[model samples]
Target: MLKLREKLLLNTALLALVLILQLAGLMKGINTKVDSLLPSPSPSLLSVLTAFGGDVFLIAFSLLTVLLDVRNSGKLSRETLVFLVSAVIGLVIVGVLKVAINEPRPRNHGGFSFPSGHTYRGAIIAVYASNRWKRATPLAVLFALGVAMTRLLLHVHWFGDVLFSLLLAPWVYSIVKATQDSWLPLYRRVISRLGLGAFDVE
Candidate 1:
């Protein structure tokens, strides 16, 4: 298994490369080319797929996964808490980046679009699922890719935006994993003191 530190370093390098491409205007050219290859709009089907990528859908999925994990183990697992925390961190980072970059959407939808939130959500869920359940990795990856493709097909996000978000997922997960051992005990202690020890994993 790859260590968390190794994963973090790899993802950070890839993110830096993507950012450099975006800043150099190369990502725009790439996005245009990729968009040109997509089929004409099929709003009905595209809408359904796009909905799967939404924050609401991802949050529900995360909750469902947590419930299932707890049910199976008969206790809240550290993995579940880590997954939730990673998702929140990813969202905050993406929100901040959107404000800082302030890139426009491909369809002129009037908001920052350097990184697609939907894509990020999909990728983050996929990473969380894959890490928690090794057997689900392939399906999780396909689902994430499908969501990324939907952004391009809908013309709501540039190719680079989706790509960057996809990379952001594993990067965020790695950060959480690398620090989890050090901080989780502290977190558990705080929760216990707050009368929330029921949620803490054994």
Candidate 2:
């Protein structure tokens, strides 16, 4: 069973990546390419995501979450809840920044252009699956990266926006994981009282 602290430790590598990219003038070339990938909105598969905005992918990601949760280990219940909380925290962080910066979408739709919400949520679920299904690590990472690519292909977000998927989501997930861990005592107590710890996800 993966402990919450161990799960948080697993993300240290990703956090290092974020630290590097977040610095000004760091990875300029990669950043520019990321921004360039946000295509003009239209009927193209890529543009369609943008045309419809982010709602479509959000729903799709939710489905991914449910599927992964069902397939994951019982010990991951805390981590699973953490991932959900992180997704919301990421959304809220983006929303606050977007409104404060008043950074309109490329075509002025709405949303800050710094970090893409689609990428963040996609990354969280991807990490969730990868960690829980260790045998499928590469595939899980690829799936997450693919989601980031889709965001760029559809012009729903810029390259940097997609890049944030790997960059920021780890930190957000850690925050949620830590918060959840803080309440583990209560959870164990509740489980002990209900004797549900013996139950499994199926």
Candidate 3:
């Protein structure tokens, strides 16, 4: 568990690191270097691999996590709620940054791509799964790295973008964990009062 002060400090440091990397023009150099070394996989195979980090997969995965908890615990669990809320927060953060930063992709295709959304979701899954299952941390980290690599191979994001996702995930998770104690009970009470007791974690 992270204390609030620790979480704040960590978040500030991450933000500072990414900003410095961007301002120093190191991001473009790294992206170009990585692109030169890594060969893009076949389009069909890349499509399938990248889907693991897309919206459909993540939504299904999130619902499945909550449903499995319901099956075993007979109600929503606080950990599942924390995961869901943190995921939502992460999405919002990414969306706002994408618009605000307006950074173009390496491929110069469509969408603004400052931070890789696919990598962000993958990292979030890694953090949540590792918290729930200590033994799975290595596999979880590999999965997240795979997602990050896919974004680079697809030319949809810069190296720095995915790097930021990797940093942002743990920082977001730490904040969620640190603040959960204050919000969980209020969430429970609100859901209970709304006659949604089955969804209540408390």
TM-score against native, each model: 0.91, 0.61, 0.90
Query: How much lDDT does candidate 2 score?
Result: 0.61
User: What does candidate 2's lDDT look like per residue over 1-202, in tens digits?
Assistant: 8777776666666655644564453645665566575554554665543322255665676666556655665433555556656777778876665465443344444556656666666677766667667888888677667767766665545565566556677767767665765766675677578877532222
User: After TM-score superposition, what is the CA distance of residue 166 in candidate 2 from its true location, in Å?
Assistant: 2.3
Clashing pairs in 2: 34-159, 46-153, 46-154
Question: Per-residue CA lDDT of candidate 1, range 1-202, in tens?
Answer: 8776777888899999998998788888888888778776877999899888897798789778767866777557877787788888988988998998888987577888888899988998889889888999999999999999988888888889999999998888888877898988898888789887547775
RMSD of 2: 6.0
In what order do the candidates fall by lDDT, top score first? 1, 3, 2
lDDT of each: 0.85, 0.61, 0.84
Which regions of candidate 1 deviate over 4 angstroms? 1-5
State which candidate, 1 or 3, has the greater lDDT.
1
Worst 10 residues of 3 by lDDT: 19-28
List clashing residue pairs in candidate 1: none
* Cα lDDT for residue 116, candidate 1: 87
Maximum-TM-score candidate: 1
Candidate number with greatest lDDT? 1
Model 3 TM-score is 0.90
